[model samples]
Target: MHTRDPHGCCYLLYSAVVPESRPAIPRPMERKILIEAGHRCAIPTCRATPVEIAHIDPWAKVLEHRPENLIALCPTCHTRYDRHEIDRQSMLAYKRQLQQLQNDSGHPTQPLIKSPYMISTLVIVDEHGIQVPNPFKLSEGSHNFECMATYVDGSSASYDPYWTCPLLDRRGKFILWAVLGRQRRSSVAISASMKHERYTELACWVFPPDGSERPPFNPCSAIGFDYSYFDSPTDE
Candidate 1:
């Protein structure tokens, strides 16, 4: 169950290499990791890049790319992580710090809603085939029945999204939403759709109360959040 590195470090090697082909992290999810670390290594001391996403929990066991379990790290830090030089608790702490940083820096006015714990973006690639890698905050109202989302561009006002169809897990805990929004002063409405040649499936990430994680029900159901323009906006 334990493998020792040459430096006498021990790690759970059995849960290391995934036997089957591992699934890829959604583009949006991966971008979330990079953005958290400012596109550098998540290690506080070594903030170097090009960065790669590291699974806080081993992929071999979890087999899911849940955002809670992913982090951005440079190649060296990644190697150190794989070699057990870095540990899980540290990674988890890093995630907590980064999330707090994002919240403090982006939205100074905190929501008065009970479901304020949620901080995720629901991305659906538009018909035009482009998406924004940046994540805009989605502020929820009571019961999350109706909500407004804000997407910021370098110039102009924030894009407002009137979101609905929040997807819940078996426990009736809402984890994802079907979103609709448009750029400031735009006429057209935009929505996200995933149509495969065979079938389209929907699932939600289940977050445990204990800050633990479960692998996603459908690992391949991952779709990215898009901040890019849906269609060329008409000049106001």
Candidate 2:
């Protein structure tokens, strides 16, 4: 059967000859038409908020962007169609009726449904700029450390070098050890729970000279990388 929809698109109901075992039904252009129809249920007497898209012309029978052949429907109407309560002829009638209603009301714009993607922040980098395939664990609590600082003698000017200190993690929890070099000779060790809600930045400095070396680290790959609580709402 051939028909011309309100959008002036010609379509043929030729799916009757297609095999029932076709992998899946196709409705590529149906969604765009539904979006153009406003995201409201197309059925009369229902007026339910639409959460699904339906083809006025069964996708199995036809394929084309005939605005008169697309409808925005709530899940309930969709389920009714699946349950065999709504036949093809009635559905087409409803589709035309809905199109007329939309034309009369002068409202054809639909709400834009934004679909977002997900991303992870736990990335590890080494000196060569390569990422580690395996994950590493961090220890909690104050890590005691020793650094060489000059000890003052009787003259008060004579100094013996070395000092012991503590470092704190992002959560204020003590992180025992973090490797800064392959030999592990120099490292930033933290101890105790973090006092701040979140640490925006991290930098290290060597003593005595006061500013000889300072390195900034990313908090995501650091101790606060366990973001199990930050769920992406778009995740299926």
Candidate 3:
């Protein structure tokens, strides 16, 4: 059978029976698929989580773990695809759409890592509950923070005088744990694992810096960035 790689189309070989126990997918490749899906179901409308990496072409047919043939799906969505409720064309479209988004976010495609690094980057798809992840703590100091769900790379988003707290999406997903410094003067240092990496282009709330009363939404606007690249944080 045939499949498409990032460069172009390629071919896959079929096996009569699916391996009862396929080797655990290599961690780096698994991470690639997770990042591509923004760690959620690839279905644009049903982007539920906790996600599972799935084969676009059934493993029973292809009999190999190729990055091009993989996608991320929630339990329900995975079941739907397996049951043929979701078609191959639609699934391929989802992969293409997300890859385009990551490229548009400015990172382009990166090579898999021998080691993973964490940094301060986030994407808030919906505003609701706020939470923080571990390797994080607050001492006594200020921090400069930005709302990067829409305007990653530091927009003129409002951050008030001073605040330090965890932030979660409305879906209760742990998107980020922000201990932001005061607005305008983002000079507060923060503490987080420098190895954590995050990127997403999903549109959320990124208030304008101009102090405008209303900011129209732009669905295509990019989100998240390597905050450490510019706003490297420090401990109090």
Candidate 4:
């Protein structure tokens, strides 16, 4: 039997069925929708991945699983939409933006420069907002080292780096490591632990290859790290 839903989509009602004879449900078409959306939340300014599929029209009203009726949304946005904090019109606009992004082919790219050799000074800040000079120093051929840096509530802004360095002390306690690269900006990932009961911050300053001048540390410029250089098993 077929019944028209409120949004004019027809849904089949199974009046009688054997428990083991039911057809397999179709794969969630929303998975394709999320892929077309670059695996990010459809909402602008929210780059969170692994989003949930939300219906533009409430599923109860539409009873449709079509791509045009579905959108990728982060858990927070999904909850807000379900709770009526975001209205249908706004959701539709975000969906349109995603569609445009998928269709656009003329997006400009950032210019790349030769990788410069960088000099790094590691700074460790304690939970009390005190800046302490890192005792460990970067040596020739020592591209990676581990140390801890703590941050108080107001000490630094939240940022994620491209490469994450996991640090551990002699006793196996979690510590923070700030690794610097030759790029103009650095990337960091912040993880919180209940046992440690403190926030950690990673900061870096990228110097020019010629050592002509020193750049000051700016906490506001840190951003998410891009790891496109790494080769994966999927690569041909």
Candidate 5:
């Protein structure tokens, strides 16, 4: 019988076996992936935040955590991909879209104004009271139209109006007032006038109640009208 040292035998067996575990993504790399995806789900339509770091290629096959091979996906999307509801090609496409959006650096794009009850347009106003055209159409009506002001460091005050009045002019102008809200924040008075039976002319004025000096420009002002409302019913 051959006598064997148990410790030496175990060491030799351990050294002969190859490690099969995949490497985990570093914290820094994970953060970079999340940031590149705008902290939102990689799927453009999902927009869910607090995403998970997912591998484009299965770690079982690639065993790498490179940025190009990683993406940020919501738990739902990740599960969908794992379950084969979404194919690998779609996952890679979403990742590419996110990368392309990130490459458009310098001056971030503003969020588009959306409404569920009314069709409307948006105009951006600067600090010098200069109005810039940002025409958009909304299919719904909403009580509030909140957006980032160009002149303000943070998000500007919510553009919620307390009163809405329909003007008697043929131009179809409506006036909105925000006087009953909190103090310090300026009250916005808006007059949205329709023109040429197609477009709208919006005039926004800001009034500060605290006796403070007002900025030379208005940040965001928008005016739009639905042309469908003006369409006459035709006979079949």
Candidate 6:
């Protein structure tokens, strides 16, 4: 999975699987796709320039291979989509507007339309739930951990070690956690020796604070770090 970069354009390199099957996109293909998508924001009445390819369906649900599944969008729209912030009304409006534009412009009938990129830079928090710079710059790579156990309360057993919290995707604010796999060899060793059993890696997500409608970015989430070149948090 690829998170929208600060500029809203994310190259699906590390996010790609079976490179031989799809291969990396060529420059011409990328340019053509961007140009055809209107080179503006896809959101209704939003005129921001598009910077990234926003997936109509959440990447977590389906790996979209066709350009039809992707739309060139600004970082703002991309972030909102990533956070699942677009409400039903806004979604419906976007669909209607895009349809009208396509019919008027004689464009091919497809689900996604291109637009200028516009994204918002977010301040990420740390394990203590304190705001911090984008730690992604400091981390080496992305990691994915699976649930090895479950709880009587029905909560899954997956836990993140970097932030001392469990995995949770609260709203759009992604709970940024460190991939405490091989990177945290010393920490993992200490935790393992203390428990004397094979333990999983440490990870974290977001949790909505009391009375706060929105889930604040975990203290360890991207805050001050720059996203000039970065990948999404995922199990690769």
Question: Per TM-score, what order, best first?
Answer: 5, 3, 1, 4, 6, 2
TM-score of 5: 0.39
lDDT of each: 0.47, 0.40, 0.51, 0.47, 0.50, 0.40
Q: Write the per-residue lDDT of candidate 6 for residues 109-166, one digit (tens) a residue.
A: 4433221111111122333433333233323343222212122112232233232222
Which candidate achieves the best TM-score against the true structure?
A: 5
Off by over 4 Å in 6: 1-33, 88-96, 104-236
Report the Cα RMSD per candidate: 20.5, 26.4, 20.0, 19.4, 17.9, 23.7
Q: What is the TM-score of each candidate against the true structure?
A: 0.37, 0.29, 0.37, 0.35, 0.39, 0.30
Better of 4 and 6 by TM-score: 4
Indicate whether candidate 3 or candidate 6 has the larger lDDT. 3
Per-residue CA lDDT of candidate 3, range 115-153, in tens?
Answer: 101111233221222322222232333322333221221
Better of 2 and 5 by TM-score: 5
Could you say which candidate leads in lDDT? 3
For residues 36-93, could you state the per-residue lDDT of candidate 1 as single tens digits? 8899876654567798998888887788889888888888878877877656666666
The lowest-lDDT stretch of 10 consecutive residues in candidate 1 is 137-146
**Candidate 2 C-alpha lDDT tens digits along 77-120:** 77777666667665665565544444544666432111000011
Model 2 spans > 4 angstroms off: 1-32, 35-37, 104-236
lDDT of 2 at 20: 47
lDDT of 2 at 206: 25
lDDT of 2 at 168: 61
Show where candidate 5 strays beyond 4 Å. 1-17, 104-236
Candidate with better lDDT, 2 vs 5? 5
